[model samples]
Target: MKFGRRQFIGTTVGAAAALSAPAVLGQARPRVVVIGGGAGGATAARYVAKDSKGAIDVTLIEPTRRYYTCFFSNLYIGGFHEMAALGHGYGKLASDYGVNVLHDYAIGVDRGAKTVALAGGGSVPYDRLILSPGIDFKEGSVPGWDLTSQNAMPHAYKGGTQAELLKAQVEAMPEGGVFCMVAPPNPYRCPPGPYERVSMVAHVLKARNPTAKILIVDPKPKFSKQALFEEGWQDHYAGMVDRIGPDFGGDVVEVRPDSMEVVIDGTVEKVDVCNVIPAMKAGHIAALAGVTDEAGWAPVVPASMQSRMDENIHVLGDAAQQGDMPKSGFAANSQAKVCAMAVRAALTGSKVFPAKFSNTCWSLIETDDGVKVGATYKPTEEKIAKVDGFISQTGEAAGLRKRTYEESIGWYAGITADMFG
Candidate 1:
């Protein structure tokens, strides 16, 4: 309806203003990227995607298409369970929870720009970043222990490749061969894992080759569920499993993988099969980002799970510095939920709440018997504190151990469902 030049100019201005209104007023949903879809990252992605609905976008970056949990891998070594059972798929996170799962490793983190650099030549931008890349073996911590040497002396604690190597070694040993395992120092992932692995391997040896022996050279004076483990060893596989704690002159200072020997107190002991669980640190990505301390663990606020160095990023799982909590799969999953809630609050300007976490670790002593330790925790001002905990009592009846074994399988099913389903 413009008739003159001034009227025409006025009409054009009004139409342009109307066209730009929605673009200015309607905001886009915030994006969250999680690196390492193992225990912590998978749960965090699932929770954030489900809880946020359409208000948040979640992407999970992991190098593996499927996850092989270290939780029950000892059973696989013992032939009590198949490797298939320990492996999990991410279909639920992608289909049901609407999470974008990327099978790629994160190489770097650009905190200022909030972008995660991928190893496969791409960068993903995010409003919030959560990293749970798990533990990395500290190079040079043990002489003759490096990525190449790991192929010979496998540390099956990390699952995947190491698990396979150890399993193959166990299968190939002679009837009277000796298997040696050097347990890592304190503050490693899965405190009971190495011991459980030794127990399970001994169980296999007892059945396949009764004359075989397993020697555990532990750096610590004791380990998680030490009494229970020793009891199980004595009751089930006596003369097969021999453990040497620090008190018994059992500390490994160096490894000679080529010679199939480990040097402890300047003495070299040759073995048919060797597994060296060296000292662990945070994943390389976290260390490269400067989020980890000299101890190689990332520090975070107990209540918020927010990085002490970077507020926009949160660290969880084994990579995080969570004391008083054993680095178990259940612990990582619990930490993930807490981190999801914290991220939700940060994005929406809602109140950040205190965190409560729980951990339960189950290990198979034999084919039908299992042992477990669990705890419930609450965050204090500075750290996460354990509130209540329990371990499988010594001298427990066979029926009780059997029931615990069944219960452990059920727990595994339930946990994976809760994490990915």
Candidate 2:
């Protein structure tokens, strides 16, 4: 479905909801500076510029020249998608929406001055700031693993090159090789992402090296769509996959990147490839802005997506600690629209409608085999609460699964277009 403004769910948080106060315009046109042009930032920039009809100035700052969608990155590892296909550019947002797209890093956020400092030694002042920067790894969350050890044991958590490196590493493993993955704890980006990656890796090994083993050492006792993934794994790659949940010392684990060893409860096992997904926090920019809480996520108002710390700034995507919403691309994109509307209302004295949000996360277990979990959310007094939800049932027909997979393909096209355009 097209995700502009939807009917806000309940009468609980009604149309009476509004921002604390509209920004006092520093310029004739209210300027909105968006940091990290992924799903959240890009969509927010586009929506604010488009909806305002040139009334608001939107500038998007993202260091990458090309952006990759982490949602479908696992398919690339499974040989179902090409790297080029996963990449997108901001040319359309610039040319079509008149957004000033800057390919520079945001080094600091001066909340007092309402300006963002760029790595290029320039700063851009904003009437309202939108931060959609994604997740960052918690330092030393995975024992003996850090960014320096990333090459030896790749954590393909972020969107781009790490996925490439991980796929390459998986392909290079010898016959009957062991591919080990240390899955992240809860509240990470994409709850099902690591499991989907595991499924994709299993898909590759099943095709190339039939005897190869796939091992997952996960800290969590159970994961998103656990029943569905387990059912799919059993149906397709029966004996090829093995997961060690928290009960089996999956929580107490360490990795020695130099030796390619995974120490599970002090039992070291040398593996051919290790995909280490460490615990994560909000993107560093959120912390720099002093918007993030002790848990390392920027909490926001459900109605406006404005930061709890600073109302002039809004947090979107994986960075925001809005309740009941998983830190996924779809969730971020959904949150951004609400934010965009609120920002516009605050800036231009436009109508602020009640906010409705929704998200659906699709995962591919095998070719033509897909499953999803999703829900619609409404703003309540305390948090963005789940209104209703649905999931793909176990033992679903082949045709349905195929249709679900195809639906994801269409969603990819629709969402990317929605974000960039």
Candidate 3:
């Protein structure tokens, strides 16, 4: 029946803990753990830390300290940019933004315990967890191809060393050798990525190995910016590139990495280099977290980017099954901003604002020839719905195309700065 002054303070703080953190109590700050350090995860971690201003403890978990962005990596393969340019480090995020950067892979998520198990023999607790683990290749999606065959037949889809490998293989092709690309199916990362990479490879082959041939076996009948890419191939790299759509047996394909062969609809074709971009799903860790659906993508509340399965967990970027937005770096970054704001509001009693998302995917067809597709989005009752859109016209002026290319370069620089710093 005796309530001391210390007991009164404890009860008050406990009652207000859910609403706001006590600045004078010396209690531990709220913890936010983010997995993956690319477009979405890095941006989320940076924004939450920078915006929170030390009100929350933010930790970013990534296996690589220097993240090689999947976006703009094609430019490296095309010789427009260097591999070093695509790589971004987390030093600034740690120093300037006060984010705890951990170079460790997330092996498991103990959701009930609100902790994540790392491969490096430790577990970290989190008040909020953000999963932005980009993408993972779906096994058996392309027969005869897996990570084991990556060295002989590179996918080069996730950026970094794979891109280097693919470029080297393309440059090493003997005169008039065939360079084959097995493009992935729908709902893959960067819908335009495979096509842009093909264009870059064609660009490389034209300059170094003029007589070399390029081939693309695409499961889909049409792809992102298909018309513009076709026009550029005809106008610039004419008589060099050939594509086989589903109607031409592209839908059913296999590969033999040892012999460098592609089998399309039971027709075996020998090739010099094989770049197999297989079907993709959310990175494996999302499933490990028990946040992903049967379709291999994590479903999120379109407004907040929070996991549908767990309110304390959020998913972003390529891992999220938000509607309409393409699986692209731009989309992921945009979603990250929205997610960050919602998270700050939820955890820190910050101002809550309306969520608006936008995405633009730019592709370089040839030198200074750029095409882009973009749309603005808003949250609806069911999903993130598109509001307005834009695309590069097939016959845009040369000057305009050059400007688009310049714009994409600026975007790359800007986004890297935004994410890393």
For model 1, name the residue pairs that clash. Answer: none
Query: In model 3, what is the error at residue 172, expressed in angstroms?
Result: 0.5
lDDT ranking of the models:
2, 3, 1
Per-residue lDDT for 60-134 in model 1, tens only?
A: 999998899877788888887788878889998999999999998898998888899988998999999999898
- What's the lDDT of the predicted structure labeled candidate 2? 0.89
Q: Name the candidate, 1 or 2, with the larger TM-score value.
A: 2
What is the clash count for each candidate, in the order shown?
0, 0, 0
Worst window of 10 by summed lDDT in candidate 3: 11-20
* Top-scoring candidate (lDDT): 2
Please give, for residues 210-260, the per-residue lDDT of candidate 2 as tens digits.
999999999999999999999999999999999998899999999999999
Alpha-carbon runs more than 4 Å astray in model 2: 1-27
